[model samples]
Target: MNGHALVVGEALVDIVRRAGSEPVEHVGGSPLNVALGLGRLGRAVQFVTRVGADERGTRIVEHLTAAGVALTPGSTSADRTATAQAELDEKGSARYEFDITWDPVEPPMTADVVLVHTGSIATVLEPGCDVVAELVALQSRTSTVSFDPNIRPALIADPARGRARIERLVTLADVVKASDEDLEWFAPGRDPLDTAREWLSRGPAVVAVTRGGAGAVAVCAAGTVEVPAVQVEVVDTVGAGDAFTAGLLDGLWSFGFVGIERQERLRDIGTAELRAALETAAWTSALTVARAGADLPTLAERVAARKVTR
Candidate 1:
């Protein structure tokens, strides 16, 4: 472990509905998953988010606690916990409808924290998004910053404004991960690699684009590196991207690129390091999609999965 991590975003329950099955509720939210995944991977993680003092909120807390993630004080400040209705298709991909509210208090900064991660709805929604942006900007000066714009089309009221918000955050981030679909929505008809290259120019040392089963590609100042997606019988795509983000952070930490002392070195990362990080991310994502809900893998599970592949 290099240094502690701070993850700020929403914590909600996912109400999953599939054909001929009862709806199942599970603790979920993009940043929440990343925090939990990092914790399960044996990294010290602190999470700050908003959820009502309700049953679903309790579930969310319990889930994070079980994963060994610490919840910041005052995180449960909402009137009602948010919920996302996830409808699973025949192929196990999910389409989501959200009944959510996001108005989070400013997160407290801790001196020991070396990585700050945030994104998804928390980066673009309401009064809270500004707080998130401020925190990332402040932390970027001293800690490695990672972002994943797990863009939900349903939540973005204005496409232009959403793109601007994502772009601004990208500049503050040392590492940025986006799905191919997210890039398509940001710049219609533009190649995702082109957008990744543009983001790299802005400031992010690494700009990664995940292409579902096609794999993922990363653009950096040194060059680009691509990784093939690990084959898995996906239960659902929920949390896969978040898991990848967690693994990417852990890989960077392992390389001594995550602490305040080494944060500046992240900007000069080489092609080999980028590929190794992406491979770790791919494994994390593959393990998550192999199970139901957003159940990310533990360190043991990841090791075992890799062994089987070998």
Candidate 2:
């Protein structure tokens, strides 16, 4: 509610294949999910992404529109919509095979944006990745910048180059969220907490690491706070992290920790405030894992869940 958010990344259709079942398609992508999640939480948000001018592309737009997310100019591509083939295990976790294109034309920026979010393959992909990084850098001076390096090792052609690109974005971000798996893939053998701390020193005010069912830990100049995961029946962990990122942003914004006016205060946020934010993120992630695909909770659902928790 402080101001609008701009989310820049890929928007793709997920073709999920379960044993003895036909492939089910769902509109998804890390950044796109974050954008939708934010919109559902009643934030004014704009999604800037690339998709084909096909049926799948129309579905993605419809999904965003239904979630109250606005599409930026030139979000549709003339190429075919990107697709990810997800093979689900008995545990409902997925292994992905992607056929996607990510060459986007930069869109015009809106004046009311106070937060800019981008990451995943869109930060390391190609010509589009550079544009995203440039936008993040430009927005860092004026708006709070959040990043999620939802690293996909299979898609990266050059690991070293990808790491460098991620590092550069980290230097410009105010908030950074990554999973334990992402840290392991990015810096094998190094402690993830150490890496998160290192990222904090590079520039980010806070670096949050999600540790699957084990829970999450966040580090900032104030110190570190850990929150245990909310127990729930596992469905598919498709957009759980993206939901967490959205919830974290919402929590921060609600606490008056966003926008140009409050960007500097992010570094010195109190431990209680940080924990509340992490708990909000945990609850949001729990909601996603409870449902199928990357389905996130609405603001009303979140409020009801909180009341139940109390």
Candidate 3:
């Protein structure tokens, strides 16, 4: 919580198309959303991502600035800004068609960072994926590394290859978060909790899985604790997982579980404490789902939501 958080990944515009509604644009990407959510929570966060010199890219810059996320130098490109055409279903679930590039130059290592976060397309795509993997490896010795495999099946060409790339980062992470749907795709025919436990064995001190309406579960060396989702009227779950990741990281920081010196103790954190963190994550996601697009809740809003839930 004391040191800055470094988030490395993609920044794109989401062209959301719902029934009877014109396409709406929102600045989003897994890591970008996480950065925005952390900023809204009052964390000192820096975002390292690529955006074009286009209008969409300008919008992305404004959004991050408003959220208080510092943009890393050389975060822009001559290439056109990335865009995802998201078609929404009746239940507010989204299917995407992406038009983007993923080739980020190495970011400056100039910040006093305690936490480093990355994943999604940035971890699976070529060129940039290797750069991101190298960054995580370099930072793991000093920071609490967190990864979220916010999978987009359409973007992946080979399941086996994607799994290998994802596992590589899992090995470097202190914390790993994934949705139940992601687990199903990553390890077919295996139970989500079982897969999460397997991830813990790989290197991460903790593995947290979000189970939609059923809530979320965290698996660690100590044990597993599950927290049910907060009941709320649903909107599109656009950035729910990213918000959850931010909340989880925030909770971990609050519990003094960040940085290399304290990471070893993460596995030994009490189940009650882990549950509290999971609850925070679930509540954060609930707020995202209760709205449209990836409009994450502010810290004040999160506090008020907690009070109402209580």
lDDT of 3 by residue, 185-286 (tens): 999899988889889999998899998888899898789898998999998989989989999998988889987779768868888889888888888899
In terms of lDDT, the poorest run of 10 residues in model 1 is 255-264
Q: Model 3 segments beyond 4 Å from truth?
A: none
Model 2 sits at a Cα RMSD from the real structure of: 0.9
Ranking by TM-score: 2, 3, 1
As a whole number from 0 to 100, the lDDT of residue 121 in candidate 3 is: 96
lDDT of 1 by residue, 1-310 (tens): 4568999998899999999999999899999999999999999999989998889888898889999999888898789999999999998888999998888877667788888999999999988888899989988887888999999988999888888999999998889999999999888999989998998899888899999999999998889999999999988898888998888888888887787677568888899998998999999999999999899999999989899889
List TM-scores for all candidates, in order.
Answer: 0.97, 0.98, 0.98
Give lDDT: candidate 1, residue 106.
79
- Candidate 1, RMSD to the unseen true structure: 1.1
Give candidate 1's error at residue 154 in angstroms: 1.4
